[model samples]
Structure formats: C-alpha cells, structure tokens
Target: GVASVAISKCCQVSDVFTELCIASRTKSKCDALAAKLAPTTRTKITTAQVDADDVQQLCDLINSYKPDLVMNIALPY
Candidate 1:
C-alpha cells in the first residue's frame, strides 16, 4: 500500500513517470488506485489483472506493456 502511494506521489510530482500501468492479481485495486491518482497527475495510468506468482503471466504483461521501467513492490509473502 505504501509503495503504491509513494510511487503514485512520484508520478504526480515528477515528469519521469509519464506513463504508468498498475497491475495486480486483483485488478480492482489497480483500477481504484489509478482512478484516485488519474485526475491529479499527468501520468497516464492503466490497470491490468496479473498474478505475479505466474511467470508466464508476468512475462506476457511485461512484453505487452513494453515499459521503460518496472517496479516490483508487492511483498513475496
């Protein structure tokens, strides 16, 4: 939660985060976070449903998004 908030704040303040895709196993959470920050920040936010435990899924998402950077903030527990 804190990681998402911190990253979203950075997106809001800095131009470095021009485009952001918030993906999580629970797509609703990602959508909610994006909706909350979309109005305030210029960062283009998108949400996708992804189960991080699945290597194929993660890889496919990475390939599909083609982002310059990726942040894995979800705890491994």
Candidate 2:
C-alpha cells in the first residue's frame, strides 16, 4: 500500500514532526496502516475517517487535527 510506504518514509525521517494523522475514505484501511506505523515509528500516529470530496468533512478534519502540513495523494482517474 502506498500509504504504508508513505508512513514508513515518515518514520525514516521522523525528526521534523511528533505526530501523523492518517485519514481516508476507508476508515479500516487507514486504521490498519496507522496500527502498522504506530509500533514501528517514533512519531505518534492517529487515524480518522474522512471523505476528501466532502468539503465540510475535510475542513472539519483539518481543523480537528490542525496538522502543520497535509499530503493529499490521489490517482488521476
């Protein structure tokens, strides 16, 4: 999973941040990845369910997390 790879990279270079919020349309998938990352990474990892197409949901998620940066990875379909 790309998410796994991305989270692994974050663990590899975890000096810049103390936490990561993993959100996706599929909450189970996000949670699974977050679980995988949590034990291995020094940085704290959290999971949430979010549908990026929903503006309010996305905004609320961003507001809730207040992340310093967000990486939106999507396929060009």
Candidate 3:
C-alpha cells in the first residue's frame, strides 16, 4: 500500500521534509501507515481528513498543515 512515487519524491527532497498522508476516510489506516514509516524513514507522516472533491475542506487542511506538497491518494470515482 506504499506510494512508491511519493516515497521516491520524498527521498529526492531534503531529508527533513515531513510526509503527511491525508486520511480523509479512516484515521486508523493513516495512523498504521505512519507508524510503519516512522522508524525506517527520515520523513515523518501525519494524517488529516481532506476530501479532495471538497475544495473548501481541502483548502482548510492546506492552510492548517501548510505542507509543501499535497498528494491525493483517493480514488476518482
């Protein structure tokens, strides 16, 4: 379930760039992944509820987190 491209991009960036995954659907799932990635990787992962379809919600999350990049992992259904 790892995002290879995201991980690769993170690796290419500075080692300190924190990695955050938007778990809009399930917090537990995000927490589990964060736990797995925390020990081995230089990046740190956090979760937030961000429904990409909802622009306002997404914007709110962006403003709150102030991340350099936002990766969309949700299905485009």
The candidate, 2 or 3, that scores higher on lDDT is 2
**Model 1 lDDT, residue 7, Cα:** 67
Candidate 1 local lDDT, 1-77, one digit each (tens):
77687667768765788888888899998888888887788888889999999999999999999999898987879
Worst 10 residues of 3 by lDDT: 5-14
Work out the TM-score per prediction.
Answer: 0.90, 0.88, 0.67
Q: Each prediction's Cα lDDT score?
A: 0.86, 0.83, 0.64
- Highest TM-score, which number? 1
Ranking by lDDT: 1, 2, 3
Give the better candidate number (1 or 2) by TM-score: 1
Q: What shift in Å separates residue 60 of candidate 3 from its native position after superposition?
A: 0.6
- Alpha carbon lDDT at 47, candidate 3: 73
- Better by lDDT, candidate 3 or 1: 1
Estimate the TM-score for candidate 2: 0.88
Alpha-carbon RMSD to native, per candidate: 1.3, 1.3, 3.0
Error of model 2, residue 69, in angstroms: 0.2
